[model samples]
Structures are given as C-alpha cells and as structure tokens.
Target chain A: MEKFGTLTAIAAAYPKVNVDTDLIIRVERCAGTPREALGPWAFEMVRYRPDGSEDPGFVFNREPWREAKILVAGENFGTGSSREMAVWALARMGLRCVIAPSFGEIFFGNCLQNGLLAIRLPADEVRRLMALASAPASATFTVDLARQTINGTTRFEISPRPKRMLLEGLDELGLTLAMEPEIAAFQAMDRPRRPWIYL
Target chain B: MGRSLFEKLWDLHVIAELGDGMQLLHVDRHILNELSGSRAQLDNAKRSLKPRHPQLTLGVADHVVPTEPGRAGDKTPWAKNVMQIFRDESRRDGILLLDVNDPDQGIEHVIGPESGFTLPGTLLVCGDSHTCTNGALGALAWGIGSSEVCHVLATQTIVQPKPRSMRARFEGALPPGVTAKDLMLALIGKYGTTGALGHAVEYAGAAIRELEIEGRMTLCNLSIEFGAKIGMVAPDEKTYAYLKGRRHAPQGALWDQALAHWRTLPSDPDARFDREVALDCSGLVPQVTWGTSPEDVIGVDGRIPDLKPEALAYMGLSPGQPLAGTRIDRVFIGSCTNSRLSDLRAAAAIARGRRVAAHVEAWVVPGSMRVKREAEAEGLHEVFRAAGFQWREPGCSMCVGANGDLVGPGERCVSTSNRNFVGRQGPGARTHLASPATAAACAVAGEITDARTL
Candidate 1:
C-alpha cells in the first residue's frame, strides 16, 4: 500500500453528484482486465465515444485537468457497488485524493484501504474548491494528512486509526492480528451463547 | 437504557476497542464469492494465515459464472480465471463451496438465506456490498473489503469502527402493484443516495413489518445503494417460519432455543437512534430510474425529474418529459435484489399471455439453481419462454455485465437490478432500474410503462 503523507497536484472538477462506482469503472471493464489496465477505462462512458474516440468536452479529458492527480466531485461521490476496483481505477488514473461534500460509505472505506485520501468538507468549501479546480490557473491543491487540512481551506476529519494507517502504510491484516488474544476471548464466550449460529 | 438492535449487535461482537471508535468485531459467518475473493489473495495468506474457522466460512461462485449453458466458459479469460481461483482456494482451504453445478449454487445473498447459512442474531460479512441482503433475517450483516476478507479468514474477526445508527420507519400501507423495490426507490428518491451515509439503517414500522422475509431481503439488499453499509429488519414469526427446516438451521430443541434468542433481537421500544426519518407508503407507486443513479428515480406515472445537464444528456431525458413512453431495448430481471421465486412469479404473471416486443431482448435469470428448479417445476419457465424471454441459469448475469451477457452500447434497458449507473449493464448502455413486474411489463410494451396499467 502507498503511504499517504502529503500531496500537491492539479485538481479536476467534476460537479455531477452521485458519481457511482459504475460510472467510475464499469463492471465489464473491471471483470477480466488486470488492475493496472483499468486506469484508461476509468469513466469510460463519459470519457469516450462509442467509436472509442476521447470526448474532448468531458472534465477529465480537458486540458490541465487530464494531468490532475486530485479530483473535486459533487456530493455522494462513489455510491453504488462495493467493488474496490473503483478506487483502484481512480488511483491508477493518477488521482491521489478525492474531495467531496459526502461519499458513499463503502467507497469511503475502499479509498482508505487502497491508500487514497477521501476528504469530506463543508458544501461551501467543496464549491469553492470546485471553482478553483475548474480554473486551470488555480487548479492546484495541496492535501496535508499530518495537519488534517486541505489547501488550508478547511480542517478535515478522519478517524485516528485511519490517519495512522495512512501515515504508516499499515494494512488491516497486521492490526487485526495484534488483537487476536482479545478476539479469542470474545469468541470463547460468544460460542456457547449462540451455538445455533455455529452450525 | 434500552438498546437499539444496532447497539446490541455491535456490543455483542466487539472484541476490543482500538481507540478512535474502531473495534475488532468477531464475524460469526463470512461468505466469499468470485467477485471479491481471489486465488492470489488466499494463496498469499496461506503462507502466514490459514483460515482460523473454516467451518464458519463458505465460498460461493456466482459473480463470473456463465448464466447460459454451453458457451465457451472462457469468453472472458479474467472471469474464467477468477472462477477457477475461487474453486481452487475453497477446496484447498477446506471451505464448503457452491460451484455452478451445485444445486445450492446461486447469488450469495439468495443462497445465504435459503440454505440457512444466514441466521438471526449473528454477524455476517461478505466481500460484496449487497451482503446487507442477509440482514433482513435480523442478522447484523454488512459488506467488507478484500483486506477485511483476508483478516476474517485469518482470525474470524475484522477491525472496524462501529457506524452510527439511523432508522427509516415506513408508515401506512403500500398500494397494490407496489413492491419492496418501489418502496426502496421511493425512499432513495426522497433522501438521495447519500442520505444514510456513515450510518447503519434499520427498516422498521408497519410497512416494513408487513413484508415477507423475501420482500424484506429485497429492501435491505438495496440499502447499499442508499449509502448504508448495513440494513436490518428485526426478526419476527415470519423470519422464524422462513428459516424452519432449512439445511443449516438448528433443528428441534436447538430451534426452540434459537427462537427464544431471536425473539429478543428487535429494538426495545425506548431505544434511541442517532438519526431518524419517516416515509409514508400509503399510495406509493411502481418506480423507475430516469437517470444513472438509483436516487434519480420517479414514479412510473410521473415525468422525468429535472436533473443536472450532464445527467439529462447521459440518460437522454428532458426535464418533465413523460417517462412512460421512453423506448427500451432490453429488460433484465435478475440480481440479488429481485431474483427470488416471488420476483420471478411476479414477472411470469405479467408475461403469462403476452409476448416480448420485437425490438426488445428480455432475459430472466433466477437467483439460485434451487429457485430455477422450483420455477421450472411450477412452469414459470414456460411462461417466460412462451413470452419470448430467455430463461437462463442461476447467477449474476446482466446485472453486473459479466458472464458474456451484455446490453449493446447506447441501448436502453429497464432492469430489476439495484443500480442503473452508467455502463453498469455495458459500456454506453443506459439502465433504468425497476421491479420485476415493471421490467416484465416494459419487455412486452417495448417501452417503459406502469405495470398497474397493464
């Protein structure tokens, strides 16, 4: 997993709300392809034409924005589908962070697990960022995980464990094993209490 | 203080609080499917982490399996490999696997309940988001990521923060012809997709209680679409009766004990939730999506919503345009959300004497092989076939655009699946989500139409 500390990159603005996983990466695109090949197909529906030509007018395909490593999207970004391939597609597409007013629960979890920063800010701040992102001259934004701030526009909130995980590059496997003793103790007591569940 | 079901379920499974609201929660049951589980992950973990409780876990092959018989199975190398991986790993790990030919094979959510692997008052986790479908039985179930899957396989536990609780209480009765899918879409339409973000939602009140176990599952299955990881319904006599005599359910004396425990799973009268919303389903009508998101829905009789320019362009809809006469190119009636016997029966009834329109391609993929066999025994297959709908094998087919089943580019489809997001059915395909009956009606009409009118 990539350790996320700080990132400074051009941000692209996509103001469409409910940018679901299906829009991010189609199920068929993710089905048989290698994870690495998913980047080019990210947002393929809007990004390309039926003839496979790029849609020059789409936000991600526009100048400066095409090189953007940060995405400022509308609220409820990443709703629908639990496929982590959505996050993989974004990260593989060179996006290190996604800023939105809100996000789907599973998508938020997937972002953190895959070492991508998902920042939630006030709607006003998101709108402001969206404007800045759309204007190429002010498209650059910096995300500082240590300070829990984005472009110094707002103090973001991320749970401490996730913050630590991002900083240290620790995955859940190691952390879960650290609590094995406690898990065993709970199971010992729970087994007899819910015997029917075991069978 | 009285406890809500969420509180009770969370407190019961917490192994340790890792600070910052995170906890190591024991997973009583973990389910794996081809979409989420892979041979590579399991093979890598085997070097250090053997499945601690193989008996508590089961493997399901659903995602990439061919829903049609005798096709090159290798249509997509990626899918074929993943399916093989699931089979190889499950056998090596000594985990019970329901392969394509297995009579018990089906979508994980459907098989979980029908096979009795999902029980009330236990915690269940799967790698797919719709794992919440199992929560209808009063179980505390939610979807987890692959890393969490590996953790559960190694320790039978997952580390996570407990989510805040929210409840949507549905008052009044749904009008005839409206199903759980309609109620869910209506709720999503009202609240938007992010309405339940960061919280576990409990479906309660008169309307929820009135639903049968299958209906309840359909409601919870789409909870993920509403941005909630968990969607639950407290168990009742309906739940108990549904689970009785299932292969994995407790028998006789054990059943009695289980029943006694389940009776205590509902939220106490005075229990509190962090958030609450009430939706009255008094006159709710069948719903269909006009835009990509599930939240972008309207009643069948209503006009397309005034959505943003981008959505309108993508969906090929104009503001206030009547949604009824929109042409449809395909109709899909399968997915964990609405592929059960009742769903099939509802669609079959609509297609009993009608024929699919020449311009429309229609398919009915049953939720499970068991469901397929039963539907065939009842001659449901003949109804669909007689109406020009292809009756296929049990699995996630057009729902996820896998298994070589896909809607052509720029084609319009009315689907019973949970999502209608861009490219969900295929690249450049426009999907409008509806209930099985509505989809069946659309197939016959060659356009989006109200099932009630038929």
Candidate 2:
C-alpha cells in the first residue's frame, strides 16, 4: 500500500450515477493484465469504443482533465462488486481521491485498504465541486488529510486507524500483527466458546 | 439498546478494538476464487515472514474455470496456465483448492455453505462481493480486497469498521410465477441500487421465512447489487436442516450443540435497526433488467422507462418499449445467485417439453458438481438437452466474461446472474438479469417472455 497524506491536484467531473465496478474494470480485462497495469483499462467500455479506439468525448479523454488526480462523481459511485481491482485501476490512472455523495459499501472499504481515498460529501456540495472542476477558472482542488479538509473549504471525516494507516503507508496485516498476543488470547478463548464454529 | 444478529456476530468476533470505530474481527472462514487468489498475496505474506492459518481458508477455481466437461484438454493455454499456477500455489501454501474437476467444485459462494465450511454465527470473508450469499446461513460474511485477504491469511483476522444495521421485511405470500429471484429483483428496483449503502441487512418477516434455504440464498446473493456488503436471513429449522449431513458440518453431539447456538442467532424481538424497510410480495411479478444496472429493472410485462440517452443507447432500448417481446440471442442459467438445485428444477420445468428457439443459444451451468449430479440424477439434464439447451459442467460460465463462454458483442441475453452491468456478460453484450424460469422462457421464445405467460 502507498502512503497518502496531503496533495493538491486537478479534479475531473464524471457525473454519471451508479458507476459500477464492472465499468471501472470489466471482468474480461482481469485475466491477462498485471495488477499495476490495469490503469489503461479503467472504464474500458465508457473510455474506449468497441473497435479499441478511445472515446474522445469522454471526460478523461481530453485536455488537462485527462491528467486529473482527483475525481468528483455522482452519488452511488462504485455500486457493484467487491473487486479491489477497481481501486487499483483508479490508482494506476493516477487518481488519489474520489469525492461523491455516497459510495458502495465494499468499494469504500476497498479504497481504504488500497490507499485510495473516498470522501463522502453532501450531494449539493458534490455538485458544486463537479461544477468547479469543469470550469476553466479553477480545475484543481486540494485534499489535506492532516487538517481533514478538502480544498481548505470543507472539513471531512475519516476514522483514526485508516487515517494513521494512510499517513504511514501501513497495511492492515502489520497493524493487526503488532497486537498478536491479544489476537492469540482472544482465539484461545473463542475456540472453546464457539466450538461448533471450528467444525 | 437491543443488539441485532449482525451486532452479535460482530461483538463475538472482535479481538481488539483499534478505536476510531475499527476492530480486528477474526475470520472464521475465508473463501477464495482464481481471479482474486493469485500467489502474489501469499508471496507478500511470506516476504513479511508472517504465517498463515491455512486450515481456515478454502480456494476454488471458478471465475476462470472452463465449464465444458473434460475441459482440461480444451481450455485455452492461458486459462490452463492460470489454473496450474493456482493449483501449485494452493498446494505450496496448504490451502484447500477445489480443482475444476473436483467433485465438489463450484462457485465459491455456492460451494462454501454447501460444503459446510460456512456455519451460522461465524464471521466469513472472501475476495468476491457475492460472499454475502453465505449470510443466508446466519453467518456474517462479506467481500474483502487482496490486501485484506493477505492480512486475514497471515493473522486469521481482518480489521473492519462496523456498519449500521438494517432490516428488510418481506411480508405476504409470493404469488405464482414469482420466485425468490423476482422478490430480490423487486426489492432492488424498489430501493435503488445504492439504497442500502453502509448497512448490514437482515431479511425477516413472513416471505423470507417461508422461502427454502436455496431460495433464501438467492435473495441474499444479490444484496450486493443493492449496495449492501452483508445480507442475512435468521437461522431457522430450514437453515439447520440444510446444514445437517453436509461434508464439513458438525456430527452427533457437536451438531446438537451447534443447533442450540444457531437457534439463538436470530434478532431479538426488541432488536432495533438503524433502518427498517418492508416489501409485500403477494402480487409481485417476475423482474428483468432492461438497462445496464440491476436496479434498471421492470416487471416482465412492463415498458422501459425514460432513462439517460447514454444508458438507453448502451442497453439498446427505447423509452416505452415493451420488455416482453424484446429479442434475445442467448439464455444463461447459472450463477452464484440462481444456480442451486431449485433453480435448475424451475428451469427444467419450463423447458420440459419445449425446445429452445433455433435462433437462441441457451445453456445451463449448475452451481456445483453436487448440484449437477443431483440435477442429472433427477433427469433435469435430459429435459434441458431435449429442449436444445446445452448442459455444461459447473462454474460461473457466461456470468462474468472471464470464461470463454460469452454473449457476443451487441447481442442481448437473459442471464440468471446477479449483475447486469455494462460489459458484464461480455463487451457490448446487453444483459437482462432474470430468474432461471424466466430465462428458460426467453430461450423458448427467442425473446424476453414472461414465465407466467408460458
């Protein structure tokens, strides 16, 4: 996992709702590609045509927005599948953070583990960000985790463990193993208490 | 403050609270599929000099496994190599791998509980989203990422933040032509795809209790489509009976003890949920997705609604167009969601004396080899074959396009799969998520036809 602290970058607006994991990285693309190389295949159907040509009309296909590091999307983004590849594709595409009104439950968890930040804001506020991102006057936004704010205008909330993990580039295994003794103790007791589960 | 079944499962699995709402929850079972279960995660763990609890882990080659019988000689070289690597890695790591030819081989979600590795009141984790299907047995199961998979493998636990509680009560009796698949589709359509985000949902009330174990599994299988990671049905007599006699189920005295524990796994009468929702199934009709998303659904006889031009263009549907007579090029009857024996029986019943239309290509891929054998023993295979529907080996064929089987580009299909996302069946393949019975009807009609009208 990569450490994510604070950064400022251009943001792109993709206002499509119900953007699913399939759209992020289709199952067909999972077969032959290396994990880190999945970026080119991100949004394969929407970003590319059937003949394997890029759709220039898509948001990510044009201008300075093509190099966007932050994304403002519609509500219910990442609404299907628990494919961690979705986050990998986004990160591979140089996306560090996503701002939406809401997100699929598993996608939210997947983002934290992979060091891709998913920020949930009010729908109206998300609309504002989307507008600002598309406007030539201001195409960039900043997400500062240390201060828990986005663009220094809105304060966001994140749990402490995820926050620390992102700041330190720590993986869950490292954190969980640090307390091995406590885990061992709990297991020793749990085995007897829930003997049926062992079967 | 009464605790729901989800909370009870969570509280029992907690090893240490990491504060900030995150807790280290012990994984009682970890299921893995070929696509998500490469040697990379294990290698990462080995590099860190960490150990793994392989006894608690189970791996299956489903996502990329060929569903054609005697497929070893027929698989594409690439798929063969993938299988070889998975088998080698599982052997090296001592993880139980259900090979493609293994008698118990199947989709991870279907095989886990069928093999009795998924028990009630246990905390289960898998790398695939539909892991929630195991929750039908009263287990707290959800999907995790590769990193989380490695973390759980190395430590026998994964860190997770508790989700809010939700209860969806399905009241009233299901009318004829309506199945658990329809009820679930209706539920998803009623509550938009993201309606249950950030919650663990429990299915309760009259309709859910009346469903058979497999039917309940069908209901919980697509809970992910509704944006829920965990979907459960309280364990009851049906659940216990389904678990008993399974290969990994407890025996004799342990079984008795397990039943006692499972009996208490339901939500307390006074249990309160963060959100409560209800759906009446008395007059529910069969459902079929007309657009890309699962929630973009309507009744079998309903018309397509006015949707975004892009969505409409992608699905090749027009506003106000009747869904019933929509032409379909293929019909798929298998997935973790609707590939159980009951699903097979329903499809067989629909195709018993009818032949698949010449223009349509229909196939039936059972959930597990156990289901395949049972369906064959009951002569369901003969019915399908007689109807011109190909009977294939068990795997997630045509559901996720990783397998060679697919609906060609721009072709329309009626699939008994959980997702209907763009390119899910195949690139540019338009999919209508449906029940097996409805899919069979589509095969016979060479178009989207209601089973009720058959």
Docking quality band of candidate 2, CAPRI definitions: medium
The TM-scores of all predictions, comma-separated, are 0.96, 0.98
How much lDDT does each candidate structure score? Answer: 0.88, 0.87
Candidate 2 lDDT by residue in tens digits, B1-454: 6679998888989998889888888888998787777744445646664435887889898988888765643446666666777787778778889998899999998999999999999899998889999999999999877777777778888888889999999999999989999999999999988878889999999999889999999999988988899999989988889999998888998889888888887888899999999999998899999988888889998999997677789888899999999988999999999999999999999999999999999999999999999999999999999999989988888898787887899999999998888788888899999999999999999999999888
lDDT of 2 by residue, A25-55 (tens): 9876665677778999999888987688989
Candidate 2: regions farther than 4 A off: B39-42, B45-51, B72-75
lDDT of candidate 1 over B23-90, digit per residue (tens): 87888888998877773355445656778888888888888888885433547777877877778788
What is the interface root-mean-square deviation of candidate 2?
Answer: 1.4
